[model samples]
Target: MRRELICVVQHRLHDKRMGDEVMNIPRLGVGLQFNPSLMDWFPFLDQSLDALEILFDGMMAPLDGPGLMLPTMVQTMDEVVARFPLVGHSNYGGDFGFDELASTPAVRRHVPLARAFGVPWVSNHCFYSDDSWCDVWSSPLQFTQAEVDRLAVRARALQDAYGVPLAHENAAYYRTCPGSDMPEEDFLARLVEQAGTWLHLDLHNLYANAQNHGAAGYSITRFLDTIPLDRIACIHMAGGRWLDNQYHDLHDTPVVEPVWDLLDDVLSRAHPGAVILEYETESLHHHDGVLDIPRSIDAILADLERARSAWDKAYGPGNRQTTRAEAA
Candidate 1:
């Protein structure tokens, strides 16, 4: 019965073909999260990357005030867009569930950058981060029908504002928030179904959640089975560390083995538009004020190469050949 229901929802979501036509977002292939550390290495790494997931917040100045884009940053962005396709990522966008007027300012700032990059879609965390409500960086949403309905309205408005699709990433939380009526997967399924938003599925976040809460009923397979896989816009792969016996989505290390396995599993089931490696450059800099450029570049390139290889395995010439034959 559950499987049948999942099939029904999947069918509904896919039939709509939600944002592809409206946004004109193409299959971006494999890519990396762009950071300042990688600027000097682009010449060497261009061929290995298919697209770049850019943080729009990073390009702006005086984040709290009227945001400004300097000429130098614009030049840098132009160079990046010239070389590869780009996807916009928002780190500080307010809660999708918040009142539209309160969230609009932060959300509105992403539009120009998205247009400048010509990104097919823009993405943000599923959790809320409005400073007025919380001092912490982010907090998980209460998985309730009411919240889903509210988020749906706000998400659609955001997409309309950008004139492109908006995707929300599954956030990694240490503890489930109280007063949630349903599981995260169900919440996401309902949100996407009602809101017409895409899922910027983060494999590391899923892995972290399952690691911390699997005993209580969270797992990768279950999540994949539940959500509308057809709506997954892209995948985020990153590494984290174990602290206090809980896994953290640190994005400061290389891809872990389990995440790699998860990537393969997701690719086999869902064809996301892109796969991106999110590695923080600060992790490569020593506390002694030295930057290990060579080592940092190698680690990033290695993970990207692996992601590309998996992407190729899933959609390369052999798969294309089979697809063509089937079509014929």
Candidate 2:
């Protein structure tokens, strides 16, 4: 069963790689997060966008147990896959620091879907989730050596099960978990190195952490300098708002100025395979509490343009042809 599944995934994902090996993942360039609201604009986004990051949880339904993908959702996925290169994103299960017995089942459930989507790689948060704690969201793990070793085992197991690369994203938290002795960057570097996994760098999350934790300790410069930039395979850019003196990593607005500056800085140093813009369509702040769908779409396109420009500037204009060809 494992061999057959690996063969299926490799066959489906061959076009995106440089060779027959599944390990040779493609460089996807600039892309946007897939949202239902952007369905109407996809036909026109090819010039500005090079790929789409699909939230796999959105396509799932709780049929009997954990969840399954309905036929309609599969069809939607097919349609999108036919249009652009795809990268899978999920927050359910597969948490790096979660219980192995509990998270393994959920990871198994997602493997077939990842193969079906032909995603070269999939990404999830570096946090842990438990119903006993916050049922709706994940919580950051303590940055200790023991936690790093534990999560590395889980991450490696997940990567082997999926038969593809697994990239873990940094979490934005209000406060450091007790007993976290190491810095976030050091923990991440050690974790990825030990696990043989990739890093799905999220600049906005770093921005939020910097805001909440103060620049003297958790600035972007400190993060980029400490972590292994080459391990970053994918990048996420999002917008947030300051409410009650707290900067929330809310995906509900345009890419803020500071985040854009961070993106530029990261691009100049790290050569990530793709940079994706994440905007939540359902957020009230996203539409300014008004239903101006066209205007909102235009704003998204503008952000894509900015991302593409930055990517081209960093990697050179000639590579745009290669990006378009690969995304085709």
Candidate 3:
């Protein structure tokens, strides 16, 4: 039963009849997170960028507001997609790790907005955001078979409803849950396989987890090896700061040297469709109604270009061909 379901989901996602309307992200191109606050900076951004990953949470209003009706924001987003291709990434209105019933209301409403902007693929973080409700981001999910199954179902439902490929991102956990029955990588592998969904592998998230909790032999390479590389459609790289003696995926700084090295390792093995330089400028807001992004933006784009140059050197230009097993 599970095998049949997996094959069916995969077939629907890869249906070629969907054609160019569906995004085929470049294999070695730089992407940035979409921020309406940075409209002034867009003119200065490198023209070589391949795509934009929009966090629909900020782009659109909550589902309770008349079903996907953010007229002004939708107009802004439409202008963005008109100029560049877009990929969707969200926390699913703060309940991403839960069951479909808890998540689908928001995901369903978000799809029309996404389709309006011509977003072809979307991604959700693998974590819960309900309990604390204090932080800007979500807490790590509890790792167990039940949680895995719940996320798998939600992943499939999201892709089915959107009629576009949806990928689940790995969590950047500071600590492992006591009740975890399996390794985080193993749980993610099972979840992706069960849902037959793609992966939005966040390299910096994996790096942060390794730095914080890998003292007990939790190497990032081992974690990478456990995930099916062929299932990866997008790769994310970000920078963060050390808080309370633990490294967090804060997206506040520039890409560190360690993450740059790991990007090389990832490219040597898997062929992801697009690589994104994920940055968050929400906290940098000033009284002038402008963001403090000049320095950081330049740095982030340079690093992304560096990654692009390195990928071309190693894998050659546009080496996206993959075998059935690798892509499956």
The candidate maximizing lDDT is 2
Task: State in Å the error of residue 220, model 3.
Answer: 0.3
Off by over 4 Å in 2: 1-21, 36-48, 63-67, 101-105, 131-138, 282-291, 321-323, 326-328
lDDT of 2 by residue, 1-328 (tens): 2344345557776765422266544677888888665566444345445778888666765424654575456656655655667788877654653555444434655666777668878888776764232442536778999998988888877777677788889988877888999999999999999998889999999999999998547767878999999888899999888889988987878887888998889889888879988877543255345336666667777888898889999988756534556656
Cα lDDT of model 1 overall?
A: 0.73
Q: List, in order, the clash count of every candidate structure.
A: 0, 0, 0
lDDT of 1 by residue, 1-328 (tens): 1344334334433533334476644676788788665566544334545677888766765546654564457656655655666788876667464545344434556775665445778888887766453533447888899989988988877787676778889999987878898999999999988987889899999998998999998877878899988888889999877779988887767787899998888898888878988876544432333346667667777887788788878777433222334457
Models sorted by lDDT, best on top: 2, 1, 3
TM-score of each: 0.82, 0.85, 0.80
| C-alpha lDDT values of all predictions | 0.73, 0.74, 0.67
What is the lDDT, from 0 to 100, of the residue 138 in candidate 2? Answer: 34
Name the weakest run of 10 consecutive residues (lDDT summed) in model 3: 319-328
Mind giving the per-residue lDDT tens digits that candidate 3 earns over 1-328?
1344334334434543343355344453556777556565644234545677777767665555654645666455545544555677777444354434444534545676555544567777876753223542546767799888877776676676666677878878776766887888888899878987778899999888888887867778788889998878888888777778988887766777799888888888887877788766633322323335565566666776787776676677654222212345
Clashing residue pairs in candidate 1 (N, C-alpha, C atoms within 3 angstroms)? none
Cα error, residue 240 of model 3, in Å, equals 1.4
Model 2 backbone overlap count: 0
